[model samples]
Target: MICESFPVGPFQCNCVILACEETRTAVVFDPGDEADEILGSLARHQLKAVFLFHTHAHLDHIGATDLVRTKTGAAAGLHEEDMPLCENLHIQASLFGLPTPPTPPIDRFLKHGDSFSFGKEKVEVIHTPGHTPGSVSFHVPAFGLLTGDTLFAGSVGRTDLWGGSHPTLINSIQKRLLSFPDETAVLPGHGPRTTIGRERRSNPFLV
Candidate 1:
């Protein structure tokens, strides 16, 4: 597995490029902004993107979905429950005084337990809402867990936005996320990465 994550857009959402080194096939997670940079990374890695997966529909996470999809011809996916937020990019942008980007169409609706394979690598989708009604986390058994905004290094995702629920978010983290191994790397949407054990024992919200 070849995994690389970088922050993009003003919000600095973490954009991840995960690929199977043997097959040179990739799946891009959250092409928030800077389409050029995302594309460049794919080219640099000599990989072909087959899918664009979004953890949720927040503007900062889906802003560049269309551009990347157009360039790579990759299928775009999001949880069906977040379609409303995905369709309301303009409203989300207004709240932050940012430019509204085009709403990208979802080629697939991801569900809990969904699995995708790019060559020998496989990614399992875990429906872990709370941050948004449809928020999800991607788990690669051999690598790490992509928690989106659900679980962070020392904290957790905010639940003040549309469809967000504090109880649900906490439950999701405790049940869905915490079940992973202690050493499982946690690749959050923003900030530095940490491991499941570190967060479980010390994350203020979890502990």
Candidate 2:
């Protein structure tokens, strides 16, 4: 198992590259704005990307989707529920004063409980909608968890953006995220990584 995470784009969205060292098969999670960085990382590690999995569809989270897929020939994937958010890239970019890059149609729709493979590891999609209508968390139990906007290091996802609902975020956290084992390593979409047990005991959101 191999993992690499770095911030990309103006918003600095955390882009993660998880790969199987033995098979050299990888998945680029949230490509964001820097396609070159993503591809460079892949080259440095000598891994072949098989899938592009996104935790959600905010413009900042998907700024470089097309560039990455075009270069790597990897399948771009996102939650079905976030298509509206993904499609509204022009509006989303306008909100942040950034030029919108045309996003191509998703190659695949990721859904709850759906599983995808990258070499020896299988990742399951967990529909943890709160930050957005289609927000999800990727669970690779074999290599810990890659939680996107759904969970953070200490604080939980903000429920003030489009399609965001406070109650919904809390419900998703309590019902879905906390259900994982206490020891499961949690790598959120932003900020430092944390653990389920740590977030449960120390996080104000859980209390």
Candidate 3:
């Protein structure tokens, strides 16, 4: 398994590409922006996209989703509860003062425990809502976890915007995310990667 991460778009949302070195099959998690760079990188690695998944539908996390799917013929997936946010891309873009881009409808709606296999690698969907009613995280036992805008390195997602709620986000963290192993590598949406144990001990929100 091979994984790569790079920040994209104006908000610098982290876009991750995970692939199986043997099968060359891959998945793109949060193609926030810069379609050209994302596509170019995929080409460089000679990886074929199997699924395009998002942790949530915040504008910064989905700016390049439509473009990536169209170019790669990849099936797009999101948590069912976030369909509204996916459909409201334009509104979010406007609110965030970002340039409006064409957004695509989600082709697959994932439920908690639903699993996806791309090449030899596998990912399990964890419905860790609270950042938004539909926020989710992707967990790959062999690699790491892609946490979107939910749980961060030392901080957690703010629940003051949109469907966000402070209590809910905190609950999600304590119940859903904190259960993961201490060694699980956490790749977040907007910052450097860290481990579950690190955040558990130091995060103000968790402490």
TM per prediction: 0.99, 0.97, 0.97
Q: Is candidate 1 or candidate 3 better by lDDT?
A: 1
Candidate 1 residue-wise lDDT, 33-126, digit = tens: 9999999999999999999999999998999999999999999999999999998999999999999988897999999999999889999999
Off by over 4 Å in 3: none
Q: Give candidate 2 misplaced runs (Cα > 4 Å).
A: none
Worst 10 residues of 2 by lDDT: 141-150
- The TM-score, computed over Cα atoms with residue i paired to residue i, of candidate 1 is 0.99
C-alpha local distance difference test of each model = 0.95, 0.89, 0.89
lDDT of 3 by residue, 106-134 (tens): 89998999999998789999888889999
Identify the leading candidate in terms of TM-score: 1
Query: How many residue pairs clash in all the candidates, one count each?
Result: 0, 1, 0
Q: Sum up the clashes in candidate 1.
A: 0
Task: State candidate 3's TM-score.
Answer: 0.97
| Global CA lDDT computed for model 1 | 0.95
Q: Candidates ranked by lDDT, best first?
A: 1, 2, 3
> Residue-wise lDDT of candidate 2 within 1-207, one digit each (tens)?
889999998888999999988899999999888889999999999999999999999988898998889888999999888999888899999998999987756999988999988888889998899899899999997877888888898898888998998899989889988999999999898888899999999998878
Q: Please give the lDDT score at residue 137 for candidate 3.
A: 92
